[model samples]
Target: MTLTEKQERALCVLDDLIDEGIDVTNLRQEIHLSNTYSYDAVRTRLRRAFGSVENALRAYGLYDQTAEPERLELERCFYIDQDYRVSENRYKSEELKELYGISEIKFQQYKKVLLENLEREALDIYVRDTFPYGLKRDYIYKHKLWHVEKYLRNFYGHSVRKLCEEWDFSYELFNDSYSSFYITQGHIFEGLVGEVLDAIYPGRVESQRRIENCIPDFIVNGRHWIDAKLSEKTAFNRASKTFSKYLKHTENLTIIYAQKSDGVYSFPNVTLVHISRYIPELIKIHRSDLIEKINAFLSNLKINIENVS
Candidate 1:
């Protein structure tokens, strides 16, 4: 299909940004409207320009900028781009009247759209026609995915923010209309990890409850615990450190770093499960070893927890 002139321009700029690894938002700011793009206009132009705004950005080709510097910029662009933030929440419908205040419902609605858009972007690569929204991948590893392991539901920023509050995390919520924006489907990542853990242990795990000192990801069999980290090396290191710190005080704790890293990396005791290799590889595993490995994982994790406690 041919693109409109404006969309062609948008595509040109998009390809340039993707190739340059330049911030699409920054590029959009500098090239599209000369610092005049409002959130709504930007949203409109982005939707008009690309079939999948997130996918186009993921096609961002070569980021030749300074490695670390460019990465930070990518984070700002990929996660913070105003273009990807364009979707509206479905919960905006009036049915939420008695369930929450207008303000609260609006927050959840926005959260839903943001997560949906992000997932749409990430899931765009897996299948041509059957990208399931919030659908759990029954098997573990996904060789096709770029960043996530599975899709999850029933989570949003409000939940994470609530947990942050419980942990005294001091993370601040940005006013939608005012803040520059940091776009991460963090809630979805948390939710999916919680869901997968539940599947793995079946009835042994439940979504985590927010409590200052409580684990923020999952409660397995009402005892085992997980702190989910989106699959990135830095995220792994950070989560590993957090787990290390956690070991100084808690018992029966396990930090699960779900990543596309090395195809679903599961560090035996550390529990770093590579989502890429996880399910496929596990499917081929000898049932005995798989169970034994899972048991060993819990055991070593318990050892880590003992140290933390």
Candidate 2:
């Protein structure tokens, strides 16, 4: 696509900002503050020209493979923020997919790359901040070593013991600050589930009900415990352990999962329900407008569970 005159101007401003090491996360704001262009006018023109601000950045070489980690993170965060803005009813799922060039697998791969880069950056910062005098083997302690071991095994396919020998960083002090840095899909899904429950049951729904060491996502009618999970059935074993604790407090437990499954899962005192199924059914009966929000949230996750029966 040929760049419009406004887009060309915007790109020039962006280039100057990048050269000056100014933050471009708020691209519209920066553009407006830098020039006579109205903020909304620039945003609208850019969207009309490039579909999204992120796409414009990509076309302008800001998302190049050799881009600095800071630049990449800023670009990705802007992309994600734009996605959330549109997903909250500015556009439908199909429109979002078309505009963002997103598919389920592709989005997942993009997130994996983003997360890996963030983890590497976090690790570097942690080491630099904690060990200003350089790391020594004798100064390390092995507290919660298994947690770091499992994290490395899952995310990096590296063995922690070998990694410690190779990298000279304490497993105990290497905090995975990803959760602290970003709002994860799990947290968003749980919040969506709470919204749906509140819309349907109103005054009868209680959120994050604590029962001893366990806290289910919600309790409906003060009897039925509900948990919202973002994973597919592969999380059954882990969820089962938590559900077992929930069942002791309630007669039945319900799990509202985001991903689709092949068959209905069976568990003692538990019912497995896909969010697609549960939300649509309630919307059919209650006629709640929150269905659109739920659909949009699922679309952002690139999870097409809308067709599940």
TM-score, one value per model: 0.28, 0.39
Alpha carbon lDDT at 96, candidate 2:
40
Task: Write the residue-wise lDDT of candidate 1 on 1-309 in tens digits.
Answer: 455777667666554433443345344454443343344454465677665555434333222212222222212223312222223324432333223223322333344445654554433222111222212233223433323343322223324344334333324332332111212334444554554555456677766464332234676665555666544442443344455544544465655543344534333245544433344444554334444444454455436434533
Q: Cα lDDT of model 1 overall?
A: 0.41
After TM-score superposition, what is the CA distance of residue 287 in candidate 2 from its true location, in Å? Answer: 4.4
Q: In lDDT terms, how accurate is model 2? A: 0.55
Candidate 2 has its poorest 10 consecutive residues by lDDT at 79-88
CA deviation > 4 Å runs, candidate 2:
1-183, 234-237, 261-265, 280-288, 303-309
lDDT of 2 by residue, 215-307 (tens): 577999988888887655533634455556567788888888876656656778888777877666675677566777777876866633332
Predicted structure 2, TM vs. truth: 0.39
Worst 10 residues of 1 by lDDT: 125-134
lDDT measured at residue 79 in model 2 versus the true structure, 0 to 100: 23
